[model samples]
Structures are given as structure tokens and as C-alpha cells.
Target: MRRWHALLWLLGLLALAGCTRMDLAYRNLDTLIPWTLDDYLDMNREQKHWFEDRLAEHLRWHCQTQLPGYLPWLDRFEQGVAERSLDDRALRTLTDEAEQAAAAVAVQITPSAVELLQQLNDQQVSDLKVAFAKDIAKRHAEKVAPPLEEQIQKRAGNMIKRLEPWLGDLHPQQLAAVQSWARQLGEHDRIALEARARWQRALLEALAHRREPGFDTRVAQLLQRRDSLWPAAYKEERARSEAAARQLTLELLRLSDADQRGQLIERLQHLRERFASLRCLN
Candidate 1:
């Protein structure tokens, strides 16, 4: 019973962590474009929820579950993080452990993603790979277009306008204060808009002049910063959590009878194949 309780607690914690990771990932995805905070926030409540839930579910199933299997040593590393009195070295050790765990999980899961597609017939799998590649290219194109940002901003402005009348019952002073804040925000937004416009113009000018070196370098730097900096912290945290989860899964796998283990392996193989195919396209 105690073990069961511990398992439930771990799962709950994992679910929360998975949700947080999903939110961070989606926010980063949007940030990869020139879109504003308001534009992302202006998504309908249901749409936002769906995005969060979908990614969370995917992470829980693909990342969270498989992580434990690959990195069984994470349990001790995670326990160190939970302790309030851990020193810097201990923390550093935990971070290193997490990095290794996450890398292992990523490597393991990526290949399995390909197997997932194999569960489909050969033709269906081929179609899926093509479709996945096309979708990724479409998303990449959207990210590169400043016009999408402008369109999102325009939609957000319209939403704010539509909401203003509904919020008009406040005191005159309150309304004035709110309007002042809005104006200041709008000014800041305009600066960002101008910057994006300049970037777009520079890209076009670079293209016309065949001056690819500087432009390509700048883009490469931006992408490098994103890859090196942003995900590291989250990756560390995810590694710790996944390590704990992996420990749990190892125990579960151990207790499972041979037939059950076989079934689990088959399912895992399918998931891995699908994920691999997606990565190949990306």
C-alpha cells in the first residue's frame, strides 16, 4: 500500500511537470516567430487549453514514460534536488545527471518514433512521413514570415477594442489609468513592430544584393542561442523528473510477467517508430 501511494504521488507530480514543460515548449514555439505576447495570449481560451493539453499528453506518454526506462539512475539525482540543503556541487551533479538522462531519453525515443509509423502498413507509413515533413515545412515558413505576426497583432488589437466597451463601467480615474497603461503598452509594441519591419526589410535587401554572409550569420546566431540557452534549464528539470519516473517504470517492468512485458515492448516500439519518422522529417 505504501508503495502504491508513492507511485500515485510520483505520477501526479510527473503529470504536473509534464504540463509545465508543455506550456514552456509551446511558448517557446511561438517566440521562435516575431509574434507578440498579446497575440499568443489572445488565442481563444479553448484553443489555448487544447494546445496545452495536447502537448502535455504527448510529453507524458512519449517523454515521461520512456525516460524512466532509459535512465534508471535518476531516482537518486531527483531526491537530491528535493532536499532543501543541497550544496552547489550536489546541484551541479544533479544538473549533469539530468543532461545525460535527457540526452539518453531523446536518443532512445527518437528512434522509436520511426517504429511507430511501421505499425501502419508500409504505404500508410510512407504517406505519414511525407505528410509530417510537409507540415513541418509549412510551420517553418510561417515562422519566417513577418506578415503572420502583423496579422496576429491586428487580430489582437481588434479583440482589445471589442472588449473595451464591456469594461467601460469602471470609475473615470480607473478608466483613465487603464487607458494610460494601454497606450504605453501600445508604444512598446510599436517599437517591436518597427524592429521586425526593419529585420524583414534587411532580409529582402540582403537577398537583392546577394549579401548572404551577414544575414545568415545573424540567423544562425539566433538559432544557436535558442538551442543552447533556452531549453537547458527546462531540460535539466525534466531530466530529474524523468529519472525518477524511469526508476518507477523499471520496477513496474520487473514485476510484469513475460507476456505483459512483450506487449509493452511492442507498444513502445510503435511509439518510437512514429517519433523517429517525425524527427527524420524535421
Candidate 2:
């Protein structure tokens, strides 16, 4: 199902606030998903129309049913920030919550994804493989070929940019903290690249047998059990990176000034209000 977009939107609801582009991405996700999906497999007119209908259903379901539940979590986060209690444990709990939310969305969308998979002809499947190869090459060149030091620097810069809106201009020590955390998680590009290849290979294999009697069940299992399919090394590295990131976030929050905290609280409040306004209780 390529559940990253749903997962990202769900997770984004947990922490981020003021990125207009991200907000637009969620608002226009139906269009964006098709555009992104086209990179892997282009759909014919009939399939595209089916996809659009299913996407609209998903969007409406998400907005009307799923989004409202996030309000409580957002309130808890805002309260955590207000009380200066967003520590490592709290962060881990939030991560679990977000993962569960994403999993729920994945389960909901699996049937539609299976239907789409059944529609793919041989040429489309070949095109999908070609797309995967192209993506792997592009990612390798962009993320892997860069020198280690450069990658660290670039990652640190991106972290700073993402945080600056909420935290304002960071001090030297704060920037150093980001750099240190990034350096600690060094060279995950290969792991991610390999993981992508494995996922795509699995997808291709599943497509190859799409005509089997239990194809729907197989596809559902593939999408819903995506984490279980991950290589153990990838899981371990991902966990380590997540823990380090949590520690870094807590440290940064501890280092932030009152003004920065005030700004963050304001942003959180704005997001909470925005989310609350979208409740379609009918």
C-alpha cells in the first residue's frame, strides 16, 4: 500500500505545527499519492478512477473518523511541553501511539491496495520494477555517495531548519547537540537502500502470484505486517536511531529558553485548534 504517506501524516500530527507545505500535503494527499504512486506503477484510466474513488473514501474516513482522535494526544503533548515533561519516556510512548495510528490506517487501506494490485497488467509490473531500480539508483547517488562528514553536516542543517520555526535560532551548543546525534547515527543510507530493495522485491513477488486463490489475504498480510518483514539489522538500527533521536529531542527541549517554549506552545495550540475544527461529528 506504500503506507509511508499515511504514516507520515499521522506522525506529523504528533509533533509538527507550522510547515505550510506539510499541511498542504495532507490536505491534497489524494492528488499527491497518485503522483507518487505513478513513479512506481502508472495506472490506466479505469484504474485511476477507481483509485481516486478509494482515495476520496480514505480521506473522508481519515478526516472524519481518525483525525478527531488525535486531539487528545495533541492535548497531552501540549500539556507535556507546558509542564516541561516531554522526556524520553514520554517521547517513546508518543512514538508507540503514532505507530499504532499508522498501523490502523494501513489495515484500513489494504483492501483497496489489493484491488489495485489485481488490476496491474504485466507491463505495469515491469514498469514498477524499472521504477524501483531508478529510485534505488537515485537514492544511492543522493544519500550514499555523499561523504560521511558532508552527510552529517547536511542532516544537522536539516534538523535545525525543521526545529527553528518552533525553537527560534538555536545556540552553538544546541547545534552541536544536533550534529552529535546525527554523527552517532552515521551511515544508515545503505541500510535504508537495502531495505527498500527488499520491500520492492517482496512486492514484485507478491504481484507475480497475484492470481493465486488467496492473493487478497497475501497482499493484506504483506501490507499490514510490513514491520515483521524488515531485516533484523534494519530493525535494530532503526530502534537505535529512534532512541538517540528521542534523547536529542529531550536535550534540546531542556536547553530551550522560555521564549522558545512560549513559541512552541503557541504553535501547538494553533495546530490543536486547526485539528479540532476539522471534526466531522455527523
Candidate 3:
């Protein structure tokens, strides 16, 4: 009986190991080039939905599988920050990971688009590359020119404008409270923007130094470090944003009329259900 029980335990351990391996493989596959809105725009309605569903499913799987790996590192970083024990090495390591993760994901996704482009004639592929390059340049300009804080304030102001009509029958005080919440969101956005910029700068710097010997090895090291850090940073930031969202939702619910609140809740629920239904293609 003891031997049988030991055999069962060993089988269970093998099953768990298999599950972890499967999850890691799924993440690696999912992180391979994300399908953008532009990819779906050329498709028929049904095709567009199908593509979106597949894209979302893959992205969700990637997040679920990869994010857990970084949590311990991030928790340590956060704790260090809280305790004022943060060191340059820790910050640099985190920054390096963020840059590498971004690049790795980009590289993974790029092949899919490249494959699609291969099906096109030379001229068509050239045109597509040109268009893509132009978009990238424009984005680069925006990134370089915008003071992260100002850009965030502009976006927050825009969100407030968008939400104003939905905020029904609020007293002056309540309206002011909502505006205050918007300002807080703007502040959060600025922090995120700064973080993104720091990561981008790190990546660019690494690329600039790529002519040195062992460049590929260095690049691999950076990405491996990032793979260890980025997901946890992402999760920490997401949790903070979600907490704010819950707080805002509660405040909005209090200020909104019964009908408006119900309508908002219903709309949110429907959207959530729609998102949940998305699946990635095999």
C-alpha cells in the first residue's frame, strides 16, 4: 500500500510539472507578434472578429503564463522602494528587463507580419514597409516631443470630457470629485509614461552599443533579465490601476442616477463577457 501511495505521489508531481511546461510553452507562443487593429481592418466583419478573438486569446494566455514568473522580483523591488533600500543595480536590472521584454515580444510578433508580407508582391511589400516606417517615425516624434506629464494631463482632460455626458445629475461637489479623480488618473498616466520612456531609452542605448563584441550575448542577457522582471512590474502597475478603477466606479455609482448607473453596469458587464469570449487560434 505504501509503495502504491508513493507511485501515486510521483504521478501527481509529474502531472504538475507537465502543466507548468505547457503553460510556459503557451506563453512563448502567445507573445509571438500581436495582431493589431490594422490587421483586422482589411478583413470582412466575420474575419475581423475571428482575428480579434484569436489575438485576445493569445495575449491573455501569454499574460497569465508569463506574469507569475516575475512577481517575486517585483515584490522585492517594491519592498526595497518602500523601505528606501532601492539601489542603482536593482533599478538598472528592472529597466533592462523592461527593455528586453518589449523587444523580445516585438521580435516574436514581427515574423507573423513578415510572413504575411511575403505573400504580397515586391512593390506591395515595399509600400507596406514604407507605411509602417512612417507610422513608427510619427510615434517616435510623439514620444520625444511630449513631456510625459503634459501628455498625460491632456489625455486625462479628454477622458473627463468623454465621461461628462455619462455623469448624470451630479451636484457641483460630486462633479468636482469626479474631476479630482480624473486628475489622479492623469498623475498615474504620467508615471506610466515616464516608466515607458525610461525603458525605451535603455533599449535604444543598448542597440546603439551593439557594435561591440559579444553584442548578441549582451542582448540575450538583457532580455533574460527583462523576462524575469517586466511581468511583475506590469502586474503591480495593473493592480494599482484596477484599484483606482474600482474606487472611481464606486464614486461614479454614487453620483449617477439609478438608471444611468444601471446602464453603465450593464454595458460594462456586456463588454466583459465579450472580452471573455475571445479565443486564440490553434
Best by lDDT: 2
1-282, model 1: which lDDT tens digit per residue? 011011112222231132133223333332211211122123346544554554344445544454344233333433333332344444345445544544443343332222221223444434534544554445444433446445446434543343233222333443343343333333333333334344334323333323333544443332222233324444454445445433322333333344543443343344334433442133
Give the TM-score comparing model 2 with the true structure, all chains together.
Answer: 0.90
Report how far residue 217 has shifted in candidate 3, in Å.
9.4
lDDT of 3 by residue, 1-282 (tens): 011011111111111121132223333343233334252124346544655565665466445553343344445533443344444455445545544554555444343333332234445434544554564456555543567566555655554554544443455655565566555654454344444444434444544444455555444444334333244556566446544544554454455565654544343344334333435211
- The lDDT for every candidate, in the order shown, is 0.35, 0.73, 0.43
Candidate 2 lDDT by residue in tens digits, 85-161? 88778877887876776677778888888888988899998898898899889988887889988888887887788
The parts of candidate 2 lying over 4 Å away from their true place are 1-6, 9-25, 29-36, 279-282
Better of 2 and 3 by TM-score: 2
Segments of candidate 1 deviating more than 4 angstroms: 1-19, 22-98, 107-117, 147-282
Instruction: Put the candidates in TM-score order, highest first.
Output: 2, 3, 1
Top model number, TM-score: 2
